[model samples]
Target: MMNNYNKEEIEKLRDLIKDIDTAMLTTSTPEGLLSRPMMTQEVEFDGDLWFFTMKDTDKYREILHDSEVNVSYAGKSYVSVSGKVEIVEDMDKKREYWNKAYEKMLDTSYDDPNLVLLKVNVRSAEYWETGSMTKNAVNLFKKMTGSDEKDPSDMNKTIKF
Candidate 1:
């Protein structure tokens, strides 16, 4: 399916997730779905998320078998992004995202042949945020009074990119 993203929606998404540093990246595997915590790249979001991984990892193999994946983030709000994974081997692009943290964690430089970048082209996202206590209480009062009004939780939204 083609992603139809608007600037406002994209910016909203970026705003929600910009402060979060880590996300659980779920990839389809032959056995089942596998999820692992991955450090999210700090670059400004533009419908894509990037991660650094070695070529020989299980996630890499899983991505090769099935590109479909889900990435989830949690903080003040919860966000789940569904997308396709693209394994990038471009040296320049790799260098652009490379940092000291990666060098320390992976014990490898950006020039390492085994290092690869996984680019997730986000297709859609669903986010849930807890509303203010006042709003929640108002929704509760409405429900108790038999008012057919939407609950505060109903504010949770799903946006298709």
Candidate 2:
């Protein structure tokens, strides 16, 4: 169940992440697991993933009950990251995902009483990247030619993201 990926493939996965702006975060609660989609603008990935949320939200409470969580981001390409979610209440971090636009949208400062930042220390992730129609066609062509070459469409890379 392990296909070792190279540094180039690692970067490709990260690049796919750079394009998407939202993720559906699934959290485990005492009741059960629930999923909620949230804008990923506040997500700060420095090898260790970070995201902002409300302290009073159910997602936050669920994390408290069980740190185990799954965060998925996808579009043309897809990424599913499995890791532990921790609450980061640092003042400086509050100011990082904070912005004037965010204030306008949420009608509150980043330091608002309800605000919270969930840092996901991504340990490992799996991806299924079927790039585009052209890429798919190229993959088929490779198969037909018995090239056994990698086509961008059949990308399967796993990494810490």
Candidate 3:
């Protein structure tokens, strides 16, 4: 079951993932699940995530075959976002998200016809934030005393919008 997320909850989710740079993008392929590391675009999290990709790549083709995808991030917190993807070719949007570093990395100008954007319209997300050391120690003590069965470190929530 998914819970309807409020603005505060959405903001919390965004704050949790803001610092995490890369996300593992998982897609369905003929061989099975294929996961690739994609640099997360710095954008406001309003239920959509964007990444730069080439239209001719296998990842793009796989997304076309199966639009459902998962993007995962790990750090002090772990987040799993599942969504439907669409290939965007709008030049204005490209200019908005493009950066000088990308030019050096891709060896192509923003105007390159092959350059495309992957827009992931997030459906739902699950996040887990590990507790601090002190909290974990307290939870461990509680467990040892048989006072708590759940660990404080196991902080997780699922939200749908």
> Which runs in model 2 stand beyond 4 Å of their true positions?
1-10, 42-44, 134-155
Candidate 3: lDDT of 103? 92
Candidate 2 lDDT score at position 37? 82
Candidate 3: which stretches are off by over 4 Å? 1-5, 133-148, 151-153
Predicted candidate 2 versus true structure: per-residue lDDT over 33-123, tens digit per residue: 7888866654534444667787777778788888988878888778888888778888888897777877776678887878878887666
lDDT of model 1, residue 147: 93
lDDT score for residue 2 of model 1:
24
Backbone clashes, each candidate:
1, 0, 0
How does each model score on lDDT? 0.90, 0.74, 0.87
Question: Which ranking of candidates, highest TM-score first?
Answer: 3, 1, 2
lDDT of 1 by residue, 26-108 (tens): 99988899999999998888899999999889999999999999999998788999999999999999999999999999999
- Over 1-161, each residue of candidate 3 has an lDDT whose tens digit, in order, gives 11345677678778889999899999999999999999888888777889999987999999999999999999888899999998999999999999998899888978899999999988889998877888878877887998987654476888776
